[model samples]
Every structure is written in C-alpha cells, then in structure tokens.
Target chain A: MIDRTGLMVILSSPSGAGKSTLARRLMEWDAGLRFSVSATTRAPRPGEVDGVDYHFTSRAGFEQMVADGQMLEHAEVFGNLYGSPRGPVEQAMLAGRDTLFDVDWQGGQQIRASALGRHVVSIFVLPPSLPELERRLRGRGQDSDAVIAGRMEKSRSEISHWAEYDYVLVNDDLDETEARMRAILTAERLRRDRQSGLGGFVRALMAEEA
Target chain B: MIDRTGLMVILSSPSGAGKSTLARRLMEWDAGLRFSVSATTRAPRPGEVDGVDYHFTSRAGFEQMVADGQMLEHAEVFGNLYGSPRGPVEQAMLAGRDTLFDVDWQGGQQIRASALGRHVVSIFVLPPSLPELERRLRGRGQDSDAVIAGRMEKSRSEISHWAEYDYVLVNDDLDETEARMRAILTAERLRRDRQSGLGGFVRALMAEEA
Candidate 1:
C-alpha cells in the first residue's frame, strides 16, 4: 500500500442537511478513517464514555488546553467550550490515518486557518431546499414551534458559508451524496503532497538498471 | 445533472508507462469527455485523417495561429510544430464539456500556466520500475537496441518532472490506476468553482421562506 500523510477532512452543514448520515457512511466505508472527538467543558450525559463520546473536561482544564495550543480549533457553543484536541490528530497523522471533523462553518474556518491547513479537505453540504430542511426539522417532532424557528435561523446562518468550502454538495439524495464524498476522499488521498513515500519510491525506480 | 464548467485535464507520463491505455479507458468511461486533437505542422502520414488525427496545417498557418493567440500551448519536436488549439477547448467549456489532453511534461506545464490554469487538473503517471519500463518497451519488438537505449534516456528525462504534477500515480496495475483517475475526475467536477450554477442555486435556497 502507498504510504500517505493523513488528511484533515472537515464536513460542515446545517442541522438537517444529512451531514451526519454522510459522515457515518464514510466511516463505515473506510474503517481506517478516524472521527475527531472534541473536548468539551460540558458534563457528559448517561452512558457517554470519555474519549469516545468526547474528552469531557473541567472548564479550567479546557481553557488551559486551549491556552497551551493543544486545541486545533475551538469555539463557544451554548455556554460550553468545545474544541478538537491536537494530540490525537497529530498521532493519527503520524500513523497515516485520516481524521474527519464534523464542524460548523466557524470551526471549519478555524481548522483551515490552522498550521495543518495544507492537509485540509473541506466540504460543505447543502439541504435540497429550505422547505425540505424545515420539513426534516419538523419531522423530528421533539421541538416546539419556537425552537424549530430558532433552529431554522441558525441553519440559514450556517448555509451562508457554502462558498467558503473546497467542495459543496447538495444532499438531495443521500446515496449519491455519499458516493461523491467517497470520491472526494479517494482522490484527496492520492494527491501528490499527501503521499509521503513517493520520493523514495521514485528514487528506487530510477536506480533500477534498464 | 449538475451543470459545471469544463475541466482541462492533462495526463502526462514517460512513454511505456500505460498512459495511453488509461486515457483510452477514461474516454470510454465518460462519453462526454472530449479528447484534444492537436494541431501540427507535420505532413499527414498515409491514411491519416487531417482533422481527426491532427489539425494538419502548413508551417506558416501554425505560426499564424500561435501569433494570433489561438494556441493554448505549443512545442517544437522533431522539426515539427505541435499545439493544442484554444478555440475548440473554449467552445467545450462554454458547452459544459470537459477536455482531456495527452501531452508531455512541457505541454502540461505550459497549459497549467496558461489563462485556463485554474480549471486544469494535471496528473503524472510513473512506471512501477525502470526494469519494468524496459520490459514493456522491449515487448513491442519493433526497435533496434540503439533506439531502445535512446528511448530509455528520454523516459528518464520525462520521469524527472513527475513531482510537478498535482497527482502522481505509480502504474503498478492498470485497473487500480484507472479507478483512481476516475475518482479524481469525479471529485474535481464537484469543486465549487467549477459548478457555475451553484451561486444561483444558493441564492434560491436562501430566498426560500421558513
């Protein structure tokens, strides 16, 4: 197998745009893919395992990690500080394993501007239509009208950043969007800069006698 | 179907590296793909169709086209001028059809630096090994030992520029290489800049009422 450095693949979308389903399918498609688990200051719910669900930490601890530059990208969400830890991502990169991030546009921007930006492949997913998105949000049936309205506003704000991504897909059909994501992953893995062993491989080929 | 601007896909490699076979397979896979037939000052050989094989032109005519900015890129080889015509490629782009160019490293570099550089997706193919390359070169059994030696030297010169490509594949197996190329094409088609209709699509999405 060709040895390659890991890619930081960031998938961003509004709440009802099928990004979660696509991300889950991608992980199932490639067992080698590592899902980046964020470090959060919030308390874990029942059955949530540390390091698996998230790296649950105290607010002070989270702030220390951020100040020490251990966070690749961090943001404040609903009074909690959440961030992607750099240590696990760096380890994965050294081991030639790609890490996938499910983030909003703000986190995507932050990661793309980070020091490891060159390895990033950012994709934005769009809902088929605003009406479709509202339908899906309403389909959840757990939220009242006011909560759904607030979510719709948040979704609109997230959708405004579609042009900032490298690739954008309208998730009109889940299977097709999944296939496109697979294609993007496969192609990005073969990029010249990502293949770490190519230099040595080329040297060996050139040394062979005709 | 997603409407997209045309991609100028350039495939370059040393001779006997299976580039021709891969190009052929790609054409067969996508019927909409346009193979760039070059314009040349060389006289047409027996049974060679002028337009289909090459846009056979007089030396003066070729020079005039270059001076008029009609050639996307040009090169002189073996006392003949060869170039990719810009007119057809532009028309293809306007019609949302992709054009594939089978060129050497020099041609690839020129086209990439041209005005349409942003739309270009360049790939370099490498033979598995020098010995394997020599074996394939000899399999044809149509050249003298001196000619084969000269070809090997030329191949080495071509292989030196593999690092300049956006993507490079060591052609150990034809089927796997072809699959990778397809993935690259598919992913490139989804690039935000290539999809011309996306801006309006996003506008319509935002205009939808909650």
Candidate 2:
C-alpha cells in the first residue's frame, strides 16, 4: 500500500508577486490539497464564509485558542488577531490531507516554530526584479501612490528573507510559475523522510520475494 | 521571452532501485532532456556511438581533461576511468537543453563540491526494503547469487547517504515513481535563484503597464 503522508506548503510573496493567484490555481489542480483557513478577529466581509473563508472569532475566543495551544501561529496584524488553528490542520494531516497556507514571512516563521517536526515545505515567490515589482504594484491601480510606495519599500525587506525558504520561485510568467509551484509540492510529497509508510511498503515487497 | 535555462539532473540508485528504467521513461516523456554521455577510458561496447553513446577517451586523455578542469567530475570505477565532461554540459545548458546524469553517490558528491549553483538537482532512489532490494536483484536474472549479495550489502552504505540528496523516492510503484521523479526535475527548473531571465520578463510586463 502507498504511504499517504500529509504535506504542508507555505507560499509567501510580496503583494503583487501573484502568490494568491498561484495558490488558487494549485488548489484547482490538486484535489488532495486543502487551503488552511486562518482564524482572525477581524469581521468577515459580506461575501466571506465564516468557516470556509476564515474562522471568524472574537478577541476572547482567539485568546482562549492561543492559551490552549489550539492556534498554530497567531499574530496581531493591523490591530486585529490573525492565526492558524491547530485543531483543523492536525486533524486534516492525521487523515492524510495536504494543507496549503498563503501566509507572509512572519506567519511562515511562526508555523515553523510551532510545527517543527511536521512535514512542512515553504516556498518564497519573488518578482523578477525591483522594477518589475514596482510595476506590478502600479498596474494593480487599486492602491494609491503612497500605498504602492509603502508596499515597494516593504518588498525589499520581504525579499531579503527569500533564502529562508526551502524553495524559491520567481513569478515571471503565471503559467510557468504555477507549473513550477505544483511541481515542488509534488516532489516534496514523495520525499522518503516525509513518507512514514515507506518502510512498511519495502518490508511488504521483501516478504513477497521471500 | 522565457529564459530557457538548462537543468542537469543526477539520479543515483543502488542496483534494482530502477534508476535506468526511470531515466528511460523520463527521456521518453521530455524531449528537451538529453542524457550526459561520460568520457570513459574503456572501449565502447557493440552498438555504442563514439560521440553519442560516450566520448570514448584514452586514459591519458581522460586524465588530461581532469587536470585541466574540463571534467565536471570523474572517478576510476572498476579499473576504468569514467567522468562527466564539463564542456558539453555547459554548452547544452547555455543552449537551454537539460541533461541527465546516471551516476553513483561519489559522482553526486563531486558535482555538489563543484557548486554549479542552481543548474544541478540530485535525487537518490531507494527500494522499499533490504529484502525487496535483494529480491529485485535476484528477479532481474542478470546477476549470480554472489553478485546479488554484494549489491545488497552495498545498498546499505548507499542508502546511508540519503541525507545528501535534495530529494529521495522509494520505488514501490513504477508509474508513481516516474511521475514523482519528473515532478522534482520540473520543480527545480522553476526555482527563482536558477531562473535569471525571470527578472527581465517581469520587468517587461511592468514596463508595458507604465
């Protein structure tokens, strides 16, 4: 029998590097993968589902999870608490489901710290260049000039952490980028160290031979 | 335009891990990849082509290439000198052609020591178990009992170096094994550090928007 070990893929990138776009595309391609819905204190938008989009909780509830070690990683972002719940992710992984996280560098670090022994593979998406990153930000047209400037400034700091990732992909072309990200996840899933059932599978093959 | 960077993939496995089978399948699936023919001191076998099958070189010539830093990595195996030449590999990579190397753990180490940086991704394949490995060797019907025993013994040492590889695959099922190997190659190709042309491409998109 094949070993069905779970994989955790954390995708991080600057705002316009298309991390979210790639993440959505990956979910479409791989049915075994499920998005890790974050728990946040912020109120959900009109169209967002409470459990599906995010686990919306109040400050008290969020604090309780943190205290009980139910939150894998929690952070106060923009004065609202945002976190990943340990319960659902652990449950999914135990049942052999790969989880995908669209998180920032800070969140990635937090996840790493909390889930040290878990099969986690982190990838950093980079824009091809500083000029390209700035261009992507400007092209979005939704942000004001000041906001774009702030993002570009933050991008430098974020990109500096590229080396921290297990894999780094530059989002030059969406199709190619998506293909590459999918490949990384696929390769990592087959890693022997991550596949706990491999030993038993080998023993079974040996038994048949004997 | 996509910067077509060539990738060199080195796959090493103990006998019966199905390295050759996997290599053949990969070649059939991807047209862009070509096998790296080694320069050997030994004479060519029946149907081998001089330049195509191997760069069949004399011992002196092979040694010369080694001394001149022309060979990427070389070793004396079973009374014959075998080495991967640097020139053809570099040319192929520059021309956007991927190369595959069927080498052992020693060769893998040599390539890593050279630090080609981003151009090389190495994978090691393992059979599910020692008994399975022995069974596969015996089932091949190509070796004597003594030879099979030697291979099984050697495999223990070979597998001990599994930590050196970027990825490891257990060959339990042929189809899944092939798919997993291909996935690693594809993913490594998309790595941001390796794809220098990505910066230019993304910049061009930004320029267009501007």
Candidate 3:
C-alpha cells in the first residue's frame, strides 16, 4: 500500500440531510478514520459520555482555549461555546489517521481557512428535495410545527453555501452517498502531495540498476 | 444522478510499466471514456489503421496543424512528428465525455500547460521496481540487448518526472491500480466545479417551499 499523510475531511450539511449518517458510515468503513470531538460548555445530556460525545468543558476553559489559539474553530450557539480543540486533530494527522469533522458551513469555512487548510477536503450534502427533507424532519415526531419551520429556515440558509465545498453530494440514497464519500477519501489519500514515502521509494528505484 | 462536465485523464509511465494495459482496462471499464489518438508523420505499419491506431499525416500537414494551434501538444520523436489533436478532445469534453491520454512526461507537461489544462487530472505509473521494469521489457522478446538497454535509459528519464502528476500509482497489482484510478475518477466527477447543472438544481431546491 501507499504510505501517505493524513487528511482532514469536513462533512457539512443542514440537519436531516443525512450528513451525520454518512459520516458515521465512513467511520465504520475505515477503522483508521478518527472523529474530531468538539469541546462544548453545555452540560452533557443524560447517558451521554463526556469525551465520547463532546468534551464537556467549563465556559472559562473553552474561552481560554479559544483565546490561546488552541481551537481550530469555535462558535457560540444558544449562549454555549462549542469549539474543536486543535491538539487531538493535529496529533491524529501526524500519526497518519484521517479525522472527520461533522460541522455546519460556518465551521467548515473556518476550518478550511485555518492554518492546516491545505489538508482539508470539504464536502457538502444536500437533500434530494426540500419536501423530502421536511418529511424526514417530521418523521422524528418530536419537534412541533414551529420548531420544524425554524429548522427548515436554517436548513435553507445552510444549503445556500453548498457551492463553497470542494465536493457536493445529494443524499438521495444513503448507500450511494456513502460509497461516494469512500471514493472521495480513497482518491484524496492518493493525491501526489499526500504520498509521504513516494520520494524515497522512487529514489531507491532509480538507484537500482536494471 | 449528477450532471457533470468532462475530465482529461493523463496516464504517463515509463515503457514496460503497464500504463497501456491500465489505460485499456479503464476504457473497457467505462464505455463512455474516449482515447485520444495522436497524429503522426510516420507511415502506418501492417494492420495499423489511420485515425484509429494513429492519425497518419504528412510532415507538412503536421507542422501546419501545429502552427494553426490545432495540436494540443506535439513533439518530434525518432524523426517523426507526433501530436495530440485538440479538436476531438475539445469536442469530447464539450459533450461531457472524459478523454484519456497515453503519453510520456514531456507530453504530459505540455498538456498540463495547455489551454484546457484545468480539466486535466494527470497520473504517473511506476513499476514495482527497476528490475521488474527491465524484466518486463525483456519479456517482450522483440528487442535486442542494446535496444532494451536504451529503453531502460529512457524509462529512468521518464520516471524522474513522477512528481509532476496529480496522482502516482505503483503498478504492483493491476486490479488494485485500476480500482484506485476508478476511485479517483469517481471522486473528481463530484467536484463542485465539474457539476455543471448544480446551480440550477440548487435553485429549484431553494424555490420549493418546505
């Protein structure tokens, strides 16, 4: 196999577009792929593991990490600070393990503009149709009409940034989208710049007399 | 399904590295893929068909085409003029069909610097090792020792340009290399810039009231 450096795969989409499902499928497909855990100031929900789900941190700790440039990307939502700690991601990349980031457009953009942007391969997922997206949202049977409407509004705004991604996939079928994501990962790993051992291999080949 | 523009896939390798075999396999795998036939001033050998195996032309005709900017890339090899005709390639791309180029490093560089260079995805193929490449070259049984030695020299020169390509594959296993090429093609097709109908598709999705 080819020896390569790790890649940063950013999967961004609105809720109900199957972005999370696709990300999960990718992680299941490649055992070496690592999920980037976000640091959050919000209290953990019942039964949710602290580091497994999110790195639950105090607001002061999160703000300090952000101010110290330890956060790759940070955003304040509903008065709670959420940010991706840069330490683990960098460590994973240096160890040649690809890290997956499930984030919104703002976070995707911020990560792509970060210092390690060149390693990022950003993808945006879109629903097959707006009605299908709304139907999926309603199928949850938990959100009220007002909540669904607000979510739909947010989804529309997020979809507007689809063109900013390096690759865009319409999640018409979960299986097909998952396959496409795998193909993207495979191809990006083969990129010339990512093949770290290729130069030495080629040098040895040249040294050998035919 | 996604509606996308075409791509130019350049496959380059030293002779005896299985580039031609891989290109043929790719064509067999994708019926829609087109192979670029080069125009040459050399006389056709037995069973060689013009416009298929090669576009046989006079030296004056080849120079005229080159001067008129009809040739995408051309070089003089073994006292014969050889060039890739731009017309068919452009037409294939306009029709949304991918075109494959079987050329060496110089030709690859020229095509990469051409006007349609943005559409090119160049790949370099390397043999598993230098001794393997020599073994394959000698296995042909069509050349004497001196001819094989000269070819080995040329192969080394060609392999030196491997870094110039977008992707490099060590052809240790043909099936695996072909699969990697397919993955690269699949992922590249989903690139945001290549999806020509994406803008209209996104507009319709936004227009639909959720």
Instruction: Please give the lDDT score at residue B179 for candidate 1.
Output: 96
The two-chain DockQ for each candidate, comma-separated, is 0.83, 0.33, 0.86
State TM-scores per candidate. 0.97, 0.77, 0.97
What TM-score does each prediction get for chain A alone? 0.97, 0.95, 0.98
Put down candidate 2 lDDT per residue, A1-210, tens digits, no spaces: 456667778889888889889999999998879899999999999999999999999999999999998987778978999998887777778777889998888888888877543677889887866777787888878999889878877877777677667777767799988988878888777666776675666455445532
Which runs of model 2 end up more than 4 angstroms from their true locations? A1-5, A12-25, A28-31, A44-48, A64-79, A91-96, A109-119, A124-178, A196-210, B1-5, B94-96, B117-119, B128-157, B199-210
Interface RMSD of each: 1.0, 4.9, 0.8
DockQ, computed on Cα atoms, for candidate 3: 0.86
lDDT of 1 by residue, B1-210 (tens): 567889999999989999989999999999989999999999899999988989999999999999999999999999999999999999998889999999999999999999999899999999988889989999999999998999999999999998999999989999999999999999999989899999999998899886
**Clash count (model 3, backbone only):** 0
Q: Distance from true position, residue A205, model 2, in Å?
A: 7.8
Local accuracy of candidate 3 as per-residue lDDT tens digits, A1-210: 667778889999989999888888899999999999999999999998998999999998998999899999999999999989999999998888899999899999899999999999999999999999999999999999999999999999999999999999999999999999999999999889998989998998999977
lDDT tens per residue, model 1, A97-210: 999999999999999999999999999999989999999999999999999999999999999999999999999999999999999999998888899999988888888888
lDDT of 1 at B36: 97
Which DockQ-derived CAPRI band holds candidate 3?
A: high
